[model samples]
Target: MSYTIKPWQDLTIQDDYMFKLVMRRKPICKRMLEKILHVPIRDIRYSDDEKTMKFQYEGKGIRLDVYVADDKGTVYDIEMQVRKPSDDGLYLRTRYYQSMIDMGLLEEGADYDELNPSYIIFICPFEPFDKGRHIYTFRNVCLEDTSLELRDGATKIFLSSVGTADDVTPDVKRFLEYVNGILSNDAFVQEIDQEIKRVKKLEEERVRYMTYAMKMQEERKEGIKEGREAMQHEMQHDLALKMLKDHKPIHEIVRYTELTENQIRKIAAENSNVSFGEESGRNV
Candidate 1:
């Protein structure tokens, strides 16, 4: 026997849902960073507010989807992109964010004696660079000699072509797959069935309100159109009377109003007694 699927059985992009799927995976991210960077993480703090975060580039402001920092003063900016960005675009964002994090450490006139390392981890569904299969880690290097590497400031990690069920050692990979799977699978419908029901009810209510708003807008348009037509008719009538008083030929008034001579003459006759009073005040 086939079972009927309920319409109100889908996960919504609510804050709680996002927190559970993404932010809750902070431990995994911290573990992955520690493994890759070989640094010990004392603790991880996730920022929910966008104001606390800093950005580098212009145009559109970077509202960090998820921002976390390790206890050792190493900040990790992990962003999720549904679509892939170009290599240059990705690097630009990563470098800009990394620079912002570094700049935040020092105050004006203070000696740049000590600064903590920072890492920006970008997780994209689509692969941006053709580096290799699994993961790519990048850092600044001396162009003159391939041997020299800059280890002073920041590092970047890019995870590409990652899916729900892929063999990976890093804890970050597991968390990424889990979240992606939950979003793209029917299991979430089964797991969070009650939340799905609530989301569906809210969606239906929104649709109903939108429908009512549309109807009200249509009615307002119709009223405005009728009012405009009435004003046009009144203006045409006044024009007809003025032309008649000025001894303008009926053809002229008809041409102005796009009305036949009989119509213009009738309007003129109806307002024949009506006189346009002289200007009460003269221009100095």
Candidate 2:
């Protein structure tokens, strides 16, 4: 896959890396949650410095853009999604993330009832559900009785930048508009814009971005090199197979295809229909 690194100065809050940096400001993050959830957040703390969690037992992991917990034991995992998810992909991802959050909170042999309430929030520039709503909040509910709630303590919220409905607070509206590249006079928006400029001016941040881009480029080059080698290897085996089918001796196939005797024999072994033989007094 090809990756083009955007310049640091060109980054906005919508950028995942920038968003994570901005959310590191606890005041801004807490205010954001309060505005979006329409609740008061006394205080919040980072679950980890990097907000990355790994499910080592399953060999799977997630790198969250922002992960925090409030004084009330409520956990929030915020993500900045630039691309639109296909069908229920995002919803399913929320399910997996919620499970990971629960797994992280519980100790070995811990009671399930001790699980904290968690929220998986995705802020996107594009509408996820095509519902034209500024925000979509989901929770488990009984299908047979719509009024019956499962109260699973797990919630998923999707905020859309292009939403048409007036379903969010003024602060959230300003935030969403800012995400859409529309500058607002709102204090929160101005603060975020200033933070973007401030971060871009940091020498260490510039170096970090540069290093990341260079690393990605190196990995891409390595992948291309490996791909080419793999193609050449497969081509050699194909040529060896064709030569063997043409009644060529093992040594002749080896000299032409640059394949060893063992490799040619292995290919012949797989293709039971192909006749295996040595000819022309060649010893392989």
Q: Which portions of model 1 show Cα errors greater than 4 Å? A: 1-21, 24-29, 35-40, 51-60, 107-113, 163-176, 179-284
TM-scores for the candidates: 0.49, 0.76
TM-score result, candidate 1: 0.49
Error of 2 at 117 (Å): 0.6
Q: In model 1, which range of ten residues has the least summed lDDT? A: 275-284
Error of 2 at 213 (Å): 3.6
lDDT of 1 at 12: 38
lDDT of 2 by residue, 196-275 (tens): 88988999988987886788689778879988998999999999888767778787888988988888989987886664
Itemize residue pairs with steric clashes in candidate 1. Answer: none
Enumerate clash totals for all models, in the order shown.
0, 0
Q: Pick the candidate with the highest lDDT.
A: 2
Candidate with the greatest TM-score versus the true structure: 2
lDDT of each: 0.57, 0.86
